[model samples]
Target: MRLNIKSSILFALLVSASAINFSASVPDEGMFPLSELHKAGLKKAGLKISEKDIYNPGQIGLVDALVRVSGCSGSFVSPNGLIITNHHCAFSAVQLASSPLHNYLQNGFVANSYEQEIEARGLTIRITDSYEDVSKDILDAIAKTDDPIERIAIINKKKAQLVKEAESKDPSIKAEVSEMFIGKTYVLFKYKTIEDVRLVYIPRQDIGEFGGETDNWVWPRHTGDFSFLRAYVSPDGKPAKYSKDNVPYQPKKHLKVNPNGVEENDFVFILGYPGKTFRHRPAQYIEYQQKFLLPYTSELNDFQNQRMLEAGKNDKATELALATRIKRNANVMKNYRGKLKGLRNIDLIADKQKEDKALANFIQSNTALKAKYGTLMSDIDKHYQLVFTDAERELWFNNLYTGIRTYQIANLINKLKIETAKKGTLAQKNEYFNKNIALVKKELDAVYESYNVDADQKIAAHMFAQAYNLKDKNVIQTIANKNFKSADAAGSYIAQNIANSKLNTKEKLYNEVLNNAATLLAYDDEILKSQQQFAHEHAPFNQELTRREGVLNKLMGDYVAVKEIYQDKSFIPDANSTLRLTFGNIKGYSPADAVYMKPFTTVKGIIEKGNSGDIDFRYPQAIEQAWLDKNFGAYTLKGTNDVPVDMLYNMDTTGGNSGSPVMNAYGELIGVNFDRAYDATINDFAWNESYSRSIGVDIRYVLWIADKIDNAQFIIKEMGI
Candidate 1:
């Protein structure tokens, strides 16, 4: 057997991490040693962990309290079984569960009890208990099939067999035999999901998203970013739908809110589903970001923001509706700019490359194992090298322009007009067009607003002139012009035409053209109807993604096979969506020669950024004054409001991870991990732990938002001190 293929691979790597206490008694890193950490940290705190310390998180009782609200990790804080998570985590559900009169986000929502709690369709929470090491079985089954496609089929067949076996027994539990680190390993994780997870409490959008996109990533955070919800189970205690008879899901254990509050350097914890971070990326990627991507993106954001603001200043309603998209893109632009500058500093990335090469050499030492996964590691790097080049990112950005809301609307209007051609009735036509006329108006202005006509037309002309192979620019422009909202009529002109008898050919559209107020109305949004789900879902793109997965998986399996044979520590790819833990000390690094961000920030930093008029930097006046005047000695801000929060932790997380908890060994609420610094944007592909500080909006701020700020007593009480 190759050295890399040997079972000793994992043991050797642990030694390399210089992980404290190399004994078998300590739990493995994959599961995060939650129960062990609780036992160790709690006892040290003079707290005891008894059988009662055990938690039945949804259905996985074996998981300790630390898993609570982290990602399928939460304790039943209330006797009624309430779950707490970041407000953004609840956005999708809140969007789904909301109504015209009962918007969950605009005004904070609270369901008095379970029955009234809105069940947002398809939102699910699952707890896993049964995990079987099916690595050997799976690898053996797929060994002969070197072709990636065949290998995927073989692996899937094996996984299906395992799932079939599990279903025959429990029937209720969903059995998933999945690959970890790609096909290099397999784990059969059985989950008992609670489908009836309900919304219990959500803050008004003003508070939950207060400072909105401006305050999203940057900290010294006054953002009131928390929400509470619960899961309900049937009387029988198995997973069931919402019913009057069901009971509040009893969590493994609920966390103490620490209203007495967190102190600087106190052992604070955050347990929530953290999206993802790459702490093992190469330094070259970091350099590429600082040199190319950051400048391009920052320029792009500035250009877009200025154009949108200029076009929109004279038009308030036009700005109001489209500002949402502009604001979001600006946020990404800001995040990368900050992260790129922060990550480019030598301390985080220079040493990173040194470390990466060491891991590469470890693979080289084990000849037999190297033969299997050695190429896998190199190939994985190769894929990224090929796919993540500067040109590729530009290509990706160009693709995004196609999906812009303004662009989509232009196309939709033409489709609607074609649909109504032959149908004819004056009153019926008036009603139909009246419903959609606002869309046409918005579409017309939106296209013009998207870019200066000369610039827009020039880009259109340039794109058309320069391209070797091209699609319909004229069609796009045609849709942009006449079809988009009566070709520029004001609100009054539209109002008078609804009843006019002069036009009859397309009465439906004529009516809409006449009656549509310039502002958006209910029928204007497409998400209202879930049709064309296939085109919307983009079947072909998904098919390509699946094929790419096979390539990626084969790359994964080979690495594990070689690493195991070599008896080297197999570097597990950072969690794609499963659980993962990354640890680092609280420290600051040089942004350049003279610029050093002390590990934390003070309220003063907020004031500085505010006066600077950095559009991305937001500090509401009331909150800004409160922080400046308030006592924060107990909280350390080494720089002005730029303090490093607690160490970030969570299961796999990604784009949606904004405002997640960064828990510690204690499983208590600590800091909120908001955004990663930009220079390491590529870190999502790999972990370069040095540069990656899970940027957190301190818990002090969350409590501050609850108490001093919004002063929502209803919410503070629900935290259930």
Candidate 2:
């Protein structure tokens, strides 16, 4: 049944199902519980998956792959620092370097020599290497303090000291050195970075991302989701900025793309940040997601897609802007649906219930565990209900964001200030202004149109009526058209209406802005002043949070120590956003016995989904022809034509893991993580151990696409295959 209504419907009656029993009608193969898979992952990560090993190699492998890839997460293939990351991670650089004459996204980019590569923007990656048992210091400090503010403060200061001490020893390491999972963990991670990065070679969109958006986040599908770029350093063998002289960063080990594809259950392993899985969430939270939130996100995404498609038809620029938003939202929607489906699986939920019962029984005798976490399930329920109550409000708030004009007043001031401060004469200033006039005009235009001067009055009316429990269509439509207006008339109308509104908040911030337009426009701006004020107020809050963040880290470690059970594959929440490692054999599963999945994908799948000329869809005749010519070697040939182009490996990972490299037990790159199973969103709160599939584009296909399809020899040479 499709849940195609307002989210309010959830308040009347919540759907009930075994948390694990819901399946996508995937035939139930003899399977382990969600808990066991996580346990398996922890063990592979080289941690004991128990309290005793919390300080050991806990999740180093997963952490290694979970790195902030500078611009994006990447895997360190060789000790020499040869890094492999996503093309999108490098997209900003491509954009910066691109021009009317050159479009990197369209034509792709390649650097035959190392010195020519661009250093991407503000990209940095970190990995956790150590953690201390600071539980005693934290408890003692908190025990001595009473006020929440002061207690939080003291905890933070000490944490700073600990991080400093930890990171000071290593020149290359960065320490977030702080807390996680509700203030109970601490960790220090190490990292290696290359300042001089070079673009080795990238194929045209037609070959690089063959299927593009159409094939995105899909399975049982063929899509060559791959790109190649190289890391470089200076002649001094030091990481250097882009210059005339630089060299490719030799890596620890780069995985040779095995054209001979993988078969079902062939040993495979993925080392990447498999974004969240709620394998641990209580039934109430999962149920809420399944019943309401998932549908809401999907509907909202659909609306966004509709708007983008409309924009795409006439305005290319508008289409581009909306395209990014829609693409992101669509992924979210896809995951929501996938998750909902997984959550609805009857067998999956049953398995979860059985495991939960077992866990409860195991903790029944542990007094401390019982006292501290026994109520966790109920707490989870409480939190879920609390969040649910505000579902509509959240939607309203999110929707309001569409009305905001970015730095509407402040952006103009900055530009004027820049023009005012230039060293040149008025003539020079005029020249600069001339050069920038179109951009400035474009900015203003964006604020005016995008802000929905009416603040979505039409959508607002529909929502408002629902909130007030009114059901009159005419009244809603009348209210919408009546409230909204063009930019010129909006200020006066809003100010007057806002002051009269019995409905608006007393703060009346928007009203104040509208009422005093003359003064705001005459001087710098009131909006700008407020922005500054907020920034100042936020500093102390930010510092305090950062400080207490450390204290919470140590405490969290202790918490995990108490919860870590070595018997099964289990996940621990990430702290300090550090890179983690998870290890598991490359294995395929029977979502049931009738359906067995292979661990790799083949080119044949791409042929099946081939499009004649979908702009976003790129399958070049050359690539297809290569396949028709029986171009694949034994390495490329998996036993089945249905080569698992994409494989869902069971590994615990989370958000900061885009483009993370997935390696095998032998430390070979098997795939690059693109996303997590939709059902895994709950993984942020708990590992839905059942839906713990880490989605990655197969390495073999990535190589195949580059070699046979794209016919780029430079990339192959640099990859050192």
- Please provide, for model 2 over 317-412, each residue's C-alpha lDDT reduced to its tens digit, 9 standing for 90 to 100: 444334335555666677676666665654354565565566666566678768756654444444555556645544433443342233333445
lDDT of 1 at 402: 39
Model 2, C-alpha of 677: deviation from truth (Å): 5.4
Model 1 regions more than 4 Å off: 1-76, 95-122, 204-206, 210-216, 234-247, 268-272, 276-552, 560-573, 580-667, 670-672, 677-690, 697-700, 707-711
Give the clash count for each candidate: 71, 95
All models: lDDT?
A: 0.48, 0.48
TM-score of each: 0.61, 0.65
Per-residue lDDT tens digits for candidate 1, residues 409-498, read 334553454344334755554566566666765655444333332222222222222221223421222123323233223222222322
